[model samples]
Target: MTDNFYMLTWNWLADSPLLAAATEVTTKSDGEEGTFVLAGVLLSLVIIYFASKLGGELCARINLPPVLGELVGGVLVGVSAFRLLVFPESGSLAEDSLIINLLQSTAGMPTEVASSVFASQSEVISLLSELGVIILLFEIGLESDLKELIRVGPIAAVVAVVGVVAPFVAGTLGLIYIFGTPVVPAIFAGAALTATSIGITAKVLAELGELGSEEGQIIIGAAVLDDILGIVVLAVVASLVKTGEIQISNIIYLVISAAVFLIGSILLGRLVSPLLVGLVNEMKTRGQVLLTGLVFAFVLSYIATAIHLEGILGAFAAGLILAETEKRKELEEQVVPLADFFVPIFFVCVGAQTDLSVLNPAVPSNREGLIIATFLIVVAILGKVITGFTVFGNPNLNKLAIGVGMIPRGEVGLVFAGVGSASGALSEATEAAIIVMVISTTFVAPPLLRLVFKETETATEAVDKVQE
Candidate 1:
């Protein structure tokens, strides 16, 4: 009766003359409107930003990576919990209005009402999040000296190959054999598991002040290579699923294209960068260096997209070239603020997209998802751990640390699952399973990384003490 009355009050308020007048006052003229929509987006970003800050600090207090907190913060406000940050849907007022606010504030409205408003602006937010990711990869590339990457090249290649191959075999066989899932879905599971979250690994290494360490360099290099391999594997699996037959030539072409895009970007960027940098150096305009760097990043990102590779690859390549510039330090310093603001948003949005309800055991399908998630997590960990042994450089370096660094699946795994879901190739249960696996990997990797690295530090100290 109380709920019904509340609903009645809301319905009445929604139709009230004063409320309509107030809404009209907020809307703009000249055929443009949606003041409330803009308010909602701003409110969403504010909420996300603070939540991410709180979450990150909390993780630091607990001796975990800050990204872990950011992700959890997203989950808290996302559909999994408070439903504060949501992707709005098109529907009747009732389905959209889960909460009602008489306060006439973006933060106070019905979740669905906000959703409806936000749905119209989702593309804008998505574009911003995409920019955040590009900046992140670019930062990682800037940190990576070409000479360091080249030094670790052989071991990184081996680690990447084994890392990808093991997980692919593990995830595919485990899903098909254990769960009796279809071939296409099993393939997706494998591809998803094979991804190494370079952002997570790089962040963790930087947090530990070990980004320049031998193990760290190997982990970063291997992760980049792993991403390249993962992309090819995904394309091949997707093609196989779509065509219902293996197209060897197409697979070869994709492989070549991806390789050429990565290698070609580096060579071409290096070759032409001096000319570009000289032009920018001559510019007397304010923020010339910053603007020129951004232009270069965006252009490379576009080229990567044209070749069907992820745009971040291009941004990363741009960073690699720019790292060699005389103004590299200035560029890094200038970009830091931009990275700080946007990177957390990307991670939080990732967490927000997770639907924990899918893990409910009471539902038969969700229970199946949970089971698959469990199996995939095991396979994901072991597969990466196996890759550590494949690395032959720096015998004193902790292979386990490298393995742990590679464990997080982050956004790339989500991309694989998303592509599968979007194509209608995966069933709901499979989709949920992949999501569970991705989230599980993400949540687990950070703490494990801290643990392994801490242990390595402790052992080193002990060895030094004994020698002393």
Candidate 2:
């Protein structure tokens, strides 16, 4: 009787003035809402570019990786700091975003519809951030020397395999046993340790004039292979995270599918390379080569996503394939502008979404996360350092240099953190811990690399003097 009365009363009031006025107040025209969304996005981009460039410039000036600066910049502007670039996934409300606030306060954006606009703006920025990573992987694929990688195969393969397995095992088991972290999150954090920042390492080597040295070649080759293996591991772990349960059959299926996707993409891509070149050559129009290259990359990225794999993997494979073509050099040069424009967005966004409050040791609950970060840092350093000794038959080789070169996690580590966070596979503590580990390893490795190489050089000088 009570329910019937309420239903009748509600139905009677549906067309009443009170309900009509309430709906009118809450609702806005689609055009007005879209305009607000665009305004919010534009303002956000302005912030992103400023932060990325500012951070990158400062880091570049100080001899650290410019990428590190970008991450820091993001933190300063993100949830932990100014609340400038907050996201919904990182436990932030739409009102928490200063951009949304600015839109309403300045642009006559209706307060009732502000939440919708914030969501729309955030979704667009997130998409752009993802695209930035895809381009980054593509650029990495182009920079890799497939032919040289093959030539240096045996020793490089050993180093890469050891580099991956050691940290992965150590970090995963340590997290599970010591911290009592769940299996999937533990695996994800462990995988973050397995990345070697080829860009950072290569830059350091070039500065030290070791780019062509035997150890350098070995490091280069191993890092390239490390990237491929890391991608596969990411695919597998990310798949496990999505399913929320790990079955042996599922693992086998993901592994097989990843392998088939990468290998088939490469083989088919190589065959299609000639046709790509032919099409580009036939076009007398401007921008054909660059446009065609991007098309191939996007298409592969789509295919990868459709198959429940990472689109970045497809983009990387696309770069690797196009890298084998006659236009490889030209395509590489052309892609740099795009990379410069988009890649920082990904790095910055990773930093922005990270909540560093969990790193505070003062909070009793936060203590475990701090300990986890420290453990990961130790494992990350030691794991790759062990890979240095994996090389054999080269008594003169500076094994320490090889190991140190693989230590910096750099951009690749951030990729793992981003994916883990996005998938809701990591807790705030674990995510922050992973981010801390990445930053520590990245900053620590370059100076350590320099020190190890210096020792090797000094010892060589002493030996030469004695022989003389």
Candidate 3:
């Protein structure tokens, strides 16, 4: 049976036209390397352009996040079933064959070259992803009214702290005790749960017309702090992993750096606003200032990487700084096209990395994989929900609603999962669990939030009637 399986796999490999062409090219030099490189580049661009448009249309039709569509497109390409059904290559096309052969040959290359190429590709993808995230953050900052956050200060603080603490503790304990995973994996699992997709929650609030309300302000403020705390936890975990000790000095440094970055960015934004406004007014060159702003963002992101902080952190800081400028609206308008082009790439690449074949339910009965996934999901849900009870003031307000509002993990969670998997800190099973957690969180938030907001509105109307 084993031999038959091997034979079948070999036959499939041999019959692949892509594999055959790649071998012929490498062996006989039938085509120029430049031609192959150009073809690869064009293919990637074509895939990205059409997929993004198709995904956007599908998302609008289904009322789903456009990101969801991008992911679906990636899955269609990466998954075997989709590839077989759609492309249906019978191993004849040289272009397809060459690509397959090139990938296989590259896989067997010397460790250094292979690693270097992988790292280069990963870095390019990451840079594009960071650019998308920066633009997203800038939009968030531009839309935010700081006065609203200040009005809900105490409640926001309580919610943010609870949101961070509960998830970290529950996730760590669940992984360690329930799944019996190692301490490092448990730490990473816990860290993954800490990110709250402010974007998702804010979108829901906006749709319901609650975005300008007190509860909305509190949720948004808490989300900002939640993100800050999440990154701190990640840095702490990474430190512990590398040194086998959670260095107090390192923690202090990260905290201080984060504080400085946040505070300084806001201050700088305010101070630089007049000058930026003048420059934009003076230049009168359409979109040139926005281009400069992008360059600044990249510079800050590079600096953050140099200082051992995440590039997105620097990107966010740059966005915050730019937020206070009078030209924010114009900048946002100019940046949207670039964001739209690159953001889907990030989502698609993430989806491509997910191999669903490992998720087969029939194999490995009592399946440790399924068990871990279930355990992580429970922890992910319950932990975030606990934050609702942390509301310090206004007992009448639904703190549970606020907590649930912060539940979706989104892109940041995927970043943590990818980092851990790449570093070999997380096994395939654990990575799958994290991915499931992200998907669940994304899918569950909007409907849950709508229901909670409806209840809140009904209660408010009743109170108003009584007062009248």
Candidate 4:
């Protein structure tokens, strides 16, 4: 039966009209050219979506955020773990490959074949991943109100400042003293530790339906501020790494540029939003609201990238402006489905980036990196937790929850470490340790947050009874 089927397949292929054309194409390219396969792309997406949903369902069963599950699912299918989506070893995907190798060693196909396949698709996959994040942030922005952000602005700023300063100082000193890292790489590590993955925190809060609460407001507000501060820190540190000297004027210029860009964008967005709403409302087309919202987001995202800020920031700002418009509810309803489809991809990609082999005690270097990572993780947790107690407003607020919310290092930390490694600022051991710290914080924070908020709810209920 098998032999007959094989003969039939070859005979069918030989008789096909495109057979001569196919042969000519193969002759021309000699198998060197890679073509994008639609079926493969679709299969990858289906696998990722299902794996993410399964991971999310598992986390939900344990009373954790679905975001946590999506992340774990990514790890399961990512190049580091199951090697589901392997990329090239060098050339275009060299950086992405390095990241995967740091987390887990590659296996399966020959390097040449794997590289060819990844090279053809990696750029598109990366762009899609970025779009996922953009939509995620835009949804977050829609859920948030400008008034709420402003209301918590002062406390958030205070929280952000303390969060940034505490982690930087402690992380730097700990790396230098405990890990025996040099000053520059230590600075890079410290800077990496200071990053708070606000996207993860926002998703967790939103999952709990606490996104509109005072504590949530404070956390989101602080996270936005934290992101700005992180950009500044990353810029300064990256500059120092590149130049081997800190130019005070250059630092000042970068800071001012970031501040101005954020402020200017928000101001401009607010001014133009009224006209945008009017224009969209005038359109008789179906889904005009959603289309306009996306266009607005994409334009701002483009402007942000042009100015060296993360595109997600622009997306968030666009959401904020749109949130103030009359079509806010309609926009939210329309954007949810789109967000659902894309958001899990971002989390899965994040998870797939993890390298668990680093924790294997059987490997000596892994053991050493694990030790350093363990110490750094402890520091990373404590430093953020310390920020919670420093909040002066709202004595009744859940400070612990706020701190726990800020704990996850997520993508931002990985990006920082990746840059440092690329520039030769961080040693292999140090880079490995940083990735461990990032993964640990991200993994533990969700459950820890649930535990913290559970206590907060209990305390609040007790207080309510006493008042009654």
Q: Any residue pairs clashing in model 2, and if so which?
A: none
Task: Quantify how close model 1 is to the true structure by its C-alpha RMSD in Å.
Answer: 8.7
Please provide TM-scores, in order, for all candidate models, with all chains considered together.
Answer: 0.88, 0.79, 0.75, 0.88
C-alpha lDDT score of every prediction, in listed order = 0.81, 0.83, 0.67, 0.82
Over the stretch 408-456, how does candidate 4's per-residue lDDT look in tens digits?
Answer: 9998998998899889998767888899999999989988888888888
Candidate 1 clashes between residue pairs 3 or more apart in a chain or in different chains: 96-112, 99-110
Query: For model 3, how does the per-residue alpha-carbon lDDT over 97-139 read when each residue is reduced to its tens digit?
Result: 2333353365343322332333333345445655666665555
RMSD (CA, angstroms), candidate 3? 10.8
Residue 52's C-alpha lDDT in candidate 4? 91
Give the per-residue lDDT of model 1 (tens digit) for 1-468.
999999999999998999998787656331132655565556668878988999999999988888889999989977788766655421123233222122144344444344445555455566778889899888877777877888888888899999999989988998898889998889888889899988877877878888878888889889988888888888887888788887788778778887888788889888888987899889999998888888899999998898888888888888888898887898888888989988887888888777788878888888878878888889999999888887664679799988888999988888898789877888878888888889888999999998999999999999999999
Ranking by lDDT: 2, 4, 1, 3
Model 4 residue 122 CA deviation (Å) reads 2.2
For residue 396, what is the lDDT in candidate 4? 83
Candidate 3 weakest lDDT stretch, 10 residues: 84-93
